[model samples]
Target: MTKYFLQKTLSQSVSVSGTGVHSGKQTHLTIHPAPENHGIKFRRIDLPGTQDIPALFKRVVDTSLATVLGANGAIVSTIEHLMASFAGLGIDNAMVEVDDYEIPIMDGSAGIFTQSITNAGIMEQTAPKHFLIVKKPIKIVDNDKYVMVYPEPCFKITCKIDFQHPLIGEQELTFDRAKNNFEKDISHARTFGFIKDIELLKKFSLGKGGSLDNAIIIDKDRILNEEGLRYPDEFVRHKLLDSLGDFSLLGMPIQGHIITRKSGHTLNHLFIESFLKNKNAWETGPTKME
Candidate 1:
């Protein structure tokens, strides 16, 4: 049988500071190496008398604006994007220590995390890396929205989003995990939102930490940011990036082809749940490297 259970790796202790999209509060996050099989755990230094939160799908408390995970009365908010970066980089284990409930929305992209992890370097231990590979077609659909995963030897994703705005029309992005360059292709893609949501998000105190520096804000006719789009299809690219991060919450790398359409965190979580429920549809194995 192929070897399974790849050894876990973690970043050398490094810190990242930024503002939270929802809390609008400045936050500090430190990444520290953890022992094998520890997976990814979050510790909130801001709260008192609460236990650490495991970054697991079952603990996910909210997915409306972002993916939030809670456990033992403590919560970690807005984690999908960073978690995706770790997943894409094949980081199997680490401990995240933060001084706030929400992870800092660094540039609203995974580039910062990617850079930090690369700087910290990856260490392969005695154990092997584990992956959940799809064995059969499994699908989840909500009304007209849907996401599906099919058996594959490596991770792959195709995302299609249609905003129909003049600035961002329909766009699609695809990446084969084995062939794609995570840092060059996916890391810099920033999260995006419509101009129409700005007021609503502000009223809810959500975008207090958002700015052109962190996100691509588009009005009805054009992008408000003077910098223009990072890529011609950046809107969908960001969605694919977010999906990668959200899918990473599965607690292991996935070997499969995922197709998503107009889905966000909510649908992402639902898809995870569906996959978990149909455990027979997939099996855990070691990730194959080229």
Candidate 2:
């Protein structure tokens, strides 16, 4: 007899603290366990009145600078890393409480968040985990950027990138839920940007908390960060990680093969919006574990 995989949440509360990559403000975040099917939510403890924001695709207020969820004048930015951790670890439900408008940008990756969730432990709930099963091919294209989700029996992602830099001309990564280790393979991949872009972004008051400590800085002909690279294709891997986080906003895991090419947050959000509006495109059901 086969037993179905159950939905899971944190066994105890865990916290992470750091500065928001854009806000540059010190932020404290805590993840508390929720009852079965509660899904994931963010509460702004620093806000005046009610400040709860459900981490759903429909509630996503901004994608200009990280995935931002806002409601009732409360906004939480830079949440992709934390959301990635939950999705990567198959955490179905949690109540995230934050003391600032943004979640901390720890190492510009999901590594720290994954570690915290691990330390808190994962508890399985009696309810079965539901997955969004893609029934047909759904795609969104914007000039050279593209995003697509295809009907498949398992969760998988294939990402391709082509940067102008010679060092990172083109990169591709394929992640299979049954074959890939998210924590070691993708969670540690740091966000990256060109040196000139960083300087320009700083002038515009963005990436205030960005540094070598949190991101991989690339020079015109060389690398700025002495650590070199975690993986030769770390940039593409980080994009994959971000996509996972963005897709997590669907409020449940999905069973499909997601293929992306030169897509960023905007394209990712657009795809989600289209995917949701198309009623015949997907259905919810229990996942079959191998």
Candidate 3:
């Protein structure tokens, strides 16, 4: 048997400090262990007397630049990376406190967060973990981008991306929960963007903290970073990383197969709404280890 069916949380608190990619502001974030069934919730310590924003799809306020969650006039932006780290590690409950409106974009990947939580160690609770088990297919599409889920005994994700750039033309990767390692295989994939888009974001005062050190920047025909790609298909893997975070807002782990094609945060959020509306397509209960 595996621990996937058991609820878990951090054995102790862990913290990280960095700059928010879009806000260009330094922020401190700490993840504290929570009792069973608490789920992941974020509190903006900068705003006193505000309610904690539950890390769930219904609380998502914006997906234009990143997954932003809001409650009681308080907001937490760029949370997908940290949320992905929680989901990837099978962390069932945590209390994340941040000193700003946005979570820091640590190296533009979940590696640091995952490593911190792993070093602190994960504690398993006696309560059973509930999983949303897909019983039928659910899908949503926007233009040429689409996201879909199918019944599966274990969690799996298949991501595909196609860009006109020479360095990253077309790439696809599949991560099987029953077989793959999330930290080694997926956590280090960094967020990427084109040079032109970065310039435009700067014009709008967005992505002000984005740099080669934090994100993989692409020039017209080359990568702007001094170091090259982490993996041959790092681009698609990063897309997969984003998908993992976006879907984590489902409020519980899913036992299903998710396939995404050219999807981003917006499309992923839309698919989550569709999945929730189609409740008959899935059943919720304790998952059995296959």
lDDT of 3: 0.93
Clashes of each: 7, 0, 0
For this target, which candidate reaches the highest TM-score against the unseen true structure? 3
Q: List the residue pairs that clash in candidate 1.
A: 5-128, 6-127, 6-128, 6-129, 7-127, 7-128, 84-245
RMSD in Å for candidate 2, one decimal? Answer: 1.1
Ranked by lDDT from best down, the candidates are 3, 2, 1
In model 3, the worst 10-residue window by lDDT is 1-10
- Evaluate model 1: give its TM-score: 0.95
Local error of candidate 1 at residue 132 (angstroms)? 1.0
lDDT (CA) per prediction: 0.85, 0.91, 0.93
Point out the higher-scoring one by lDDT: 2 or 3. Answer: 3
Residue-level lDDT tens digits of model 2 in 94-174: 999999887888898899999889888999999999999999999999998899999988899999999988989899999
Candidate 3 lDDT by residue in tens digits, 96-123: 9999998999899999999999999999
TM-score for candidate 2:
0.97
Model 1 weakest 10-residue run by lDDT: 2-11
The TM-score that candidate 3 achieves is: 0.98
